[model samples]
Every structure is written in C-alpha cells, then in structure tokens.
Target: MEPTLPMPAAPSSIHFHANCTPTNYSTSPPNSWPPFPLAPAREISSYLNHSRHLSKSKPLPSLASSSQPRTLCFVAMEKKFVEEAGCCYYGGDVDVDGEGRATALRPAALSRPHTQAFHLAWLSLFACFFAAFAAPPILPALRPALVLSPSDSSAAAVASLAATLVGRLAMGPACDILGPRRASGAASLACALALALAAVFASSPRGFLALRFAAGLSLANFVANQHWMSRIFAPSAVGLANAVAAGWANVGSAAAQVVMPVAYDAVALRLGVPVTVAWRVTYLLPCALLVTTGLAVLAFPYDDLEGNRSAAAAAGGGNRSNTLWAVVRGGVGDYRAWVLGLTYGYCYGVELIMENVAAEFFGRRFRLPMEAAGAAAACFGAMNAAARPAGGVASDEVARRFGMRGRLWALWAVQTAGAALCVLVGRMGAAESPSLAATMAAMVACAAFVQAASGLTFGIVPFVSKRSLGVVSGMTASGGALGAIVTNRLFFSGSRYTVEEAISCTGITSLICTLPVALIYFPRQGGMFCGPSATVDDDDNDDGDVGANDDYMLLK
Candidate 1:
C-alpha cells in the first residue's frame, strides 16, 4: 500500500494544478502554491520537512461542494544572468548563446563550427597573401628576365595596389550578397587563374603589369576574412578574432619571402633548369596552393546563424544590386568609416610598402645576397603571428576598463609611436649607416609597432555600424591600397626621393592620419577624452541602454 502523509486542509473552492511553476506562483496571490526553484536536494528536503510539520499544526477546513474551484499555477523563473564558466577544451571558454554564436575567442577549439570558420577564413587568406606577394622575392631574377626598368617595376607595384583597391571595394558588397565563404573562395580561384597566367605570359612589361594587376584581386579576401570573424564571434571577442585571423594570414607574405627564393634556387641550380624557366615553374606552386585552399574554403559550412541568407535577401527586396547599393551607400555616409579608412591607409599602407620593398631595399643597401635579404624582410611579416593579436588583446583589455573611449586612445597612442619608429628607421638607413644587425633590430621593432597598429584599427571596426560591417571593412581595406598607391607614386616610383627619404615621408603621413581618430565617437561610450553627448541618438550602440557601471558588460 502507498504510504500516506498528514495533509493540510485546502481553503474552499481551491484547486492545485500539476503544470504550475515558481515563476507564476511568485507573481500570484497568497493562496496559490509554487514550483520550487532549482536548489540542492538536501535543502529542498529540509524545506519540505518544515512544511509538513506546519501543516499538521495548522489544519484548515475542507472545501465546500457548492463553491466553484479556482486553479493556481506557477513556473520556475528563467535564469537570465548565467555567466560563461566552462573550459576551452570542452568548448565552454566561449559563451555560445541560443543561436550558436560565440562570445569569446577559443582558437584552440577548432572542432566546433565557429572555430572552424575562423580557421578556414584565415587559411584561404594565407594562400591568397602568399600568391599575391610571391613575385617580389624572385623579382631580382624576374626583372632581368623581363628586361624591366625601375620605372616599370614601380608602375607594376602601383598597378597591383590599384587593382586591389577596386577589388576590395567590390568584394564588400559581394560578401553581403553571397556570404563570406563563397565570396572568399571565388576570389581565391580567380586570383589563382591570374597567377597561373602570369607564369606563362609575363614576358613583357605590359603583360607583367596586367597579370600583376589581375593577381592583386586575391587580397580582396581580407574583407571576407574580417567580416567572417565579426559574424561568428560576439562583440566582446570580435576584435581579437579579427586580429588573430588576419595576423596569422599576414604571415603568408613572410612565408612567400622565405620560400619563393629557396624554391627558385632548387629548381634553377639543383634541378639544372634555366633560371627563367625555373622562376616560371616556381610560380606554379603558389597557384596550386591557392587552388587547393580555395576549394577547401568552399567545402566548409557557411555559419549563417540566422535563418537562410536567401530568406534575408528576399526580405530585403530580392534584388542583389539594390542591396549592394544600399549597403555601400549607408557605409560610405558614415564619417567615422572615412576616418578609419584614412588611418588604415597609413598604417596598413606602410606595411604593404615594406612587404614589397623590404627584400629589395636590404639587398640593394647592404649588398646582401638574395637569400639573406629575403630572411631579413621575413622577420617583419613574422611579427603578425603575435604582435597584431597583442594589439587586439590590449584594445580589449583597455575597453574593459574605460569603455570605447579607451580603445580609441590605445589605437592613437600605438599608431603614433609606430609612425615615430618609422622615422627612426629612415635615420638608421643612411648611406653610411650602422651594422646590418643593428638596422635589422630597429626594423623588427618598427614592424611590430606598425602591425600592432593595424590590429588596433580593426578593433574599432565592428562597433562602427554592425549592419554595414562588410562595406566598412572594404572601405578600410581599400584605404590601405590607396595609401600604398599615393606613397609609391610620390616617394617610391620616380627619382624624386631615395628609399630612406620615402620611408620618413611615409611615417610623417601616418602620424597625420592618426589625428582623425579624435573624430570617431560612440554616443553612449563617447570619444577619446570626452563624455557622452546629450543630443545624439545611439541607434548604432549594439549594447543597448548601458549604464556607466555596465560598460564592462559590453567589453566582456
């Protein structure tokens, strides 16, 4: 037989409902019973024992038959404030919300979709970077084979940057239409085709210039790379995700510098192939790498956490051209985007110049062999492995303490310091200069500062306008190309300035560009060294209705 316990008498017309919970009970009147909140089993048992004793001491009369029964129900309160408290190994370090987007960067956990997207994004970009810059390391052999003049070489460099500028601008809207996965993969494949053709047809100055221009379309992958990270990670972690992905991808340029010359020697010397034919054969390797990585990127899933992208596109009027126009129009209208673009031009622009000219400069200035010069330049690109991510980490840490204003201050400070270091690099590069060892040390320091500044620039990008992230990224990225073009035309291409003089001018331009950071402001979080304005609408603030004390939540 079932054991029976002493029961409290119910009030007249009262009925208990089995489907009730604590949430409704807490909000109900005194007569309603409750669903227990989640707690330890022992604590619940103790409370039940006390309730049983109270019922025995204070029994009530039974319900009357003539009165209608009233139903009472309740539910346990939903926990709205659960914090992330899990390990990265088990995928807990990243806070995955209901929709599966991560709130923290857990790069070591690549088995998960978010982290997998991060890997694919960077790897594809790495292939593109390698293929795009591979020509420079072999330029010594290449220039002689093509019988190119210095003017032709510089014009080729400018052409590459110009093509990349246009490509980046177009890629932003393409990402909005097709998703980052498809956009990036397509770009890689297209540029691989260009690279392969360059191997076969780059016999004349015009052909080399055209092929270089076409190959530069590869760098447009940068837009997809940053946009992908921003969408997969939460606002709190987006900056670091962007930095780490791009930083690691940037290492491809360094790898190209080291690998291409070695490959050339192996093909030309060890294999007994003609030097010209060997360089052409070496080009095939990067093309193959690009093709493989691009297809791999396409094989991965598109992490569109929201419903179907096609559905979203349909909802936006089912016209891709209109959507593209709207996205670019809205993105360009933001003054902050323009400011960021100019700033990006100087820092990233200077970095581009270094990647192109570093090997050549070292070879020409110090009379080093091709292998030795390439090694020195590789060090600059290698810093992207840690220095860029360090900048993002610094930005995140400062924003946690001082809000958005803190991030801007950190960006300005580092960029200014980096520009000053660029001037120092010029001083060290004099006609009768210090030892190569000392010059290399200074170059490494300047590279770290410049790359870190690039990282810091993107740290502020996600917060600019979440709705137009791709376009804004494109604008900023294209700015780097434009800055390279102008700098190359004025300082690098002609006989106007020596390489050292050009570098100093580049540094000064970067310093002036850093001034625009003062114009970038978040309504609730304010600008650098300023409080929130009283009259501006904060529609762009993703962390809604944040209090002074709650700014940390946004950073987290």
Candidate 2:
C-alpha cells in the first residue's frame, strides 16, 4: 500500500468547479493516494487508477521511498493527474497547463473609459502629426503665394521638424509632470491655434515659418501617446499597442501628402477660388480636426501608471518639478537610453530627411518627370501604415521568444538590413540606366526597414525606465529629428560629394550605430540599466512620510 500524502491547501485565487467529474477508472487496486481537500473518494480512485496504468510494468512506488525512480514516478503521476483534470496547479498567475504546454492567456476586457482614453490618445497624435506635416504638402502653393525663395521654402519645409525636436524635449517632461490627457489636449489646442492663425493671415514667408514652427509643437503629442499606451497595456502587449498608436498617427503625414493636393484642387474647382485662397483654406480642415481631438482629450478620462485617479493625483500633485527632474536625470544618465536614442535618430531621422528629399532625389537621379518622382517619393511615406506595426509585432514575438535580448536583436537586424538597402538605393541612383521601378522598390524597402526600426526602438523605450517613460520616449524621438538635420545638411550643403555619396553616408552611419546597440545589456529581472537600484519611486515623493502614506494606501 502507498502512503497517504497530506492535502495541500488550495490557493484562494483559484476557483475549482464543484461539478468537476472524475476520470473513468478500471477496477484496479491502488497502492498509495495523495489527499485532496475537496476531491471526492471516487475522484481519488480514478486518479490512482490512471497513475497505475501509467506505471504499468513497474509497480507503484511508495510516497515515503528514498529511491530516485520512485520519486520521479510520483512526480510524473501527479503532473499527469493535474493535466487530465484540467486544474491550474500553479495558482492563477501562471498561464501554462499541467503538461507543460504554453497556453495563451486572454487579457481582461478593458473598461469603457480605458477604451475611450486609448482611442483619444491615438486620435490626438494623428491630429497633431496631420497639422505639423501640413506645411510640406502645401509648400508648392505657398511658394508662389508668399513669394518665397527656394532657400526660404527649404527652411519652411524643415521648420516643423526643427520645432518638433524642441517640442519633444520640452513635452517629454511635461507629460510626466502633467498627465497624458492634459498634455495631449494642450498640444492639440496650441497646434489648432497655430494653424488657424496661419490660414487667416499668413501672407509672408517669415509669417508662414513662424506659424509652422509653432504648429510643429504638436509633434510632442507622440510622447504623450506612448505614455498613455504604456499605462493602459501590460508590458507584454505594450510594444504592439505603442506601434498601433504611433503607426496610425504616422499615417496622418501620408494622408496629408494625398489629401492636401485633392483638397487644394477641390476648393479651386468647386468654389472657383484662386489657387492661393484654396491653399490657405485647405489648412482649416486639419485645424478643425485638431480642435475636435483636443476637446476629446480634455473630456476623456485620464490614465496613469496605477490606473487610479486618487493615486495619480497624489503622485502628481506635489513635487511635480522634482519628479520631472528625476525622470530627466535618470533617463539622461542611462547609457542604454542614449544608444537607443542615437539609433532612433538614424532610422527615424533619416526617414524625415527622405520624406522631403525622395521626390527631389528621384526626380534628379532618374531624370523622371516631377509628378512621377513625387509619386515615387510618396510610396515611402505610404508604407508606414503596415511596416511600423509589423516592426512592433516582430519585437513582441522576439521578446516573447528570447526576452530582453531578443528585442535588441530584432532592432539591430532590421537596422542593418535598412542600412544595406540604403546603400543599394544610392548605388541604383548612380547606375547608367537606373530603373525607376528598381529605385522605388529599394526606397520602399528602405522605408519599411527604417520605420520598423523606429517601432523596435520604442519597443524598448518604455522598458528602459517606467517612471521616466515620457523622457525616454522624448529623447529617442528627438534622435530622429537630429538625424534628419544632419542628413539634410550633408545632402544640401553644396559640397563636392554627390547626392549618392550623401545617401551612402547615411547607410554607413546606421551601420556604425548598430555596434553600440549590440553592446547594450538589460537585466533579466529588473529595469534596463542596472538592477533593482535602477528602479526609482514611480511617484517622486522626496518626503519619507508621504512615501509611507502612499505605500500604505496602495496596500489598502
């Protein structure tokens, strides 16, 4: 006879069904049985019969036996019974089955407010990006209307990007200090006001530049968008969630490229308006959209790290400046954050440059018609709809498979491929009979890889420092703007180097950046930088009394 094992206490979090049926059992004598607190005698008999069948040739081992074979047999039987019964034995935290098969865990349904908050965050970003990039599509109309020189027009084109860099630098800390909801609404309102002013009285080139620079502040909305998504989604799903929010918002730039021309034509043809009037009026559509999104953000419920309003208020109320400084100091001090930021600068920075230059580059390199070159250039922007999200999905898959290391690996792999594609594009540009089709294909491929790299870079941003997610995201985003500035200077600086040489330089720079990315080491259990020490108080309270009170409240 087998010794009776003591019944293990059931975890309170698990719910066992009262109507659970026992497995069919043959009429065989059992040796030993483990005690189950709630299981009926017939259920115990069924488990014993199953275990006996599993150990067919070898007799059942006594539970008290010191033999290795007997211990292995006992564990195997217990595991088998657990699997057959479909009981979750590892509390409710684990998502694996008893047989060691990985089970997909379904996320809890989101509350209505949470759902609305998420949609609002993305829509706000979309409106901001739409307004910020609106200048590029309307540049042609503006050039003739404002009597802008080529240099003035060039400056106008990059005004938003330059302004966005400053905005991101400022707004990152703002989002951390103020909640995402408030920050997003404020940014939208500012952008809408800038656009409205430009539409009503933007007669001079200088006026247009000033208005665009101010409107470019809307780009800061990206930081808030990521912060809000991080608060809403779990770490496992945050990558994809961030990707979706960013990817869709990014589509606004492409939408502007498409919509601006159509809107420009529609106003002129339908209303018999002059080309200048049509161009100025088209800005109103995005302006109205921006105002609506801003109001939505203001009206919607705000989400915080803890997803509790009282907790968020308590955390955000006092020491707001201290919290902002702490977040900035921590983000800046981390070497991994800097490396990621520079890497992002290369991928996304180059993307910004390409957006403005692609049409010109294709037009000059292949001797294509202006319209054809513009169409080819537009292809790169259009790929954002699918490519950016794909990068996030890939990062999630790699992280799921290999943890933190896998995320970095995915970023490096995509960036490396993107660099190679960049070189291919440059070489194609110099070919004797460069096929427009071939050049466009390489350009699209390059865009996809770069945008995907941007997605992967952000995939690690929120993980670097949860408390400083806004700062980290902002710094990384600013890297893209810096990269665009550098690349644009290289291409347009009127040096002896040809455009192909400049293009190849970007690829080479990207390759050099990949080395540092490989060296970044994230802890297995703690935050990205050091270990547990890297994790600071999420709510920055310098006072010990308040910290204690917050801890007590959280526990309660």
TM-score of each model, paired residue for residue: 0.80, 0.73
lDDT digits (tens) for residues 408-435 of candidate 2? 7889989889988988888888788878
Worst 10 residues of 2 by lDDT: 18-27
Candidate 2: global Cα-lDDT?
Answer: 0.65
Clashing pairs for model 1 are 20-74, 21-74, 21-75, 22-75, 22-76, 23-75
Off by over 4 Å in 2: 1-111, 305-322, 362-374, 495-500, 525-556
Model 1 poorest 10 in a row by lDDT: 74-83
N/CA/C clash count, model 2: 2
Error of 1 at 504 (Å): 0.9
Deviation from native of the Cα of residue 367 in model 1, angstroms: 0.6
Tens-digit lDDT track for model 1 on 355-427? 9899998999999899889989999899999988888888887877887888999999998988998888877
RMSD of each: 11.4, 11.9
